[model samples]
Target: MKFGNDRNSSRFRLPPSTAYRQAMRYDDKTLVVVGGSSGLGLATARAFTAGGGRVVIGGRSVERLEQAREVLGDAARTAVIDTGDTASVTRFFEAIEPIDYLFTPAASYTIAPFDHPDEAALASPFDGKFWGQVRCVRAAAPKLARDGAVVLMSGAASARPPKGAALYAAANGAVEAFGRGLAVDLAPVRVNVIAPGTIDGDLWRRRPAQVRAAAFAGQAAGSLVGRPGSEDEIAQAVLFLLTNGFTTGATLFADGGYSLR
Candidate 1:
């Protein structure tokens, strides 16, 4: 969506930031991304591989996993995992050893107003995103390295719920809280949350063009920055959480200040 008729939105591009420019050296490290087949997770996986880290990418789709492996090449290993299924999570971790970092962003759910009749729709966010991450962490605990970290995916909805997104917002809030509590529980193995704003990425691209445009415009108008964020930007933020030893029990809002407004 255009910022406005009078203003040139293209001029509002993000300035060069040190976060994306800084060198990340993860030569011998390994990253486990539960949703690494596409979008933000895929971006992070690519960045980690570029930093010389080995990645184990898990997703529900075998075809997508194979596609991701093609993009990541020998630096990555692919597996099928459905976070909503406990046994699937267990098997995904069992196949990989000594994980240096973990990021879970795979979730499938609906977001609608409270008046929606389908009970399953209301519960899907928690089932897919909140509890899904919980199951993965529980299963990965044994394989997680003491020096490693866990980064969970959350959304700006947790802070500011737009109309018809109350449950979605609540689920995201739960994930943020889960990250804090899990951080303490995991101890030396850090746990953090990346609550990103509306990103113009693969996820949104699947939606109708008109709907996608409207969502992007609305998100841009709400944020301090007058633009939607990129998958790569969120990817860099996740990497920061993964590599930073001092940070834990924290939720980093990479939402262009959407919550503030």
Candidate 2:
């Protein structure tokens, strides 16, 4: 099941003037994207940069950060960060003073039977992915502008739990809940989560080509659109959430209808 682009089917749109304005919107604004080295994070950074936003990307890998900076061009900034470390999180935030948007697409996962879950595997996902976002927000909240927004990544697992995904499912669920709670607490500084499902991105490269193709086929069989989602599709959704002032405490699903299955 190959994920195809469907630009004509997009649910959101900006008028030519608005788009032109947005294309020049980032002249003075700054955006910090944690985990922006790849996948949805990288896509989101690209979208923001295209609209003239200055983006600072943070991740655990220096090589990946440099690579992302090269890909994102001169407007893109890079920082070394370990979400699991509170001090690192503080240092990363302190380095970037005024931020207009904080997007965190960082997360880890462990798959195992609940009867015999690995403790080490569970620690990273919970501490790094789950708690990492939480701490980042807490640290950045004070500096976030009144109109600023914090976008966190959740997944379809939060809504549609699969077999052998106990740890991941629970962690995603917590992310969803955290977004809602943070929205109320952070008021006016909008908070939201993107719960994408089976999106076509580099994250799946770990699987063999044939195995991944088969999994995508399974996704298409269950999807309302009959295919997995592309990186741009998810990027569009993230852009909408970032721009829509009326929406907050929401979970936008870009899962190609897999949650409906």
Worst 10 residues of 2 by lDDT: 6-15
Candidate number with greatest lDDT: 1
The residue ranges of model 2 lying beyond 4 angstroms of the native Cα positions read: 1-25, 122-124, 258-261
lDDT of 1 by residue, 1-261 (tens): 745545446666554576545566889999999999999999999999988999999999999999999999999999999998898888888888899999999998888688899999998898989999999999999888999999999998898888899999999999999999999998999999999999999999999999999989988888888899999999999999998889999999998884454
Q: For residues 49-151, could you state the per-residue lDDT of candidate 2 as single tens digits?
A: 8878889999999999999999999989999888878999999999887888889987665555566656877554567578989989988988999998888
**What would the TM-scores of all predictions be?**
0.91, 0.87
Off by over 4 Å in 1: 1-22, 259-261
Residue 190's lDDT within candidate 2 is 91
Clashing pairs in 1: none
Residue 173 accuracy (lDDT) in model 1? 97
Index of the highest-TM-score prediction: 1
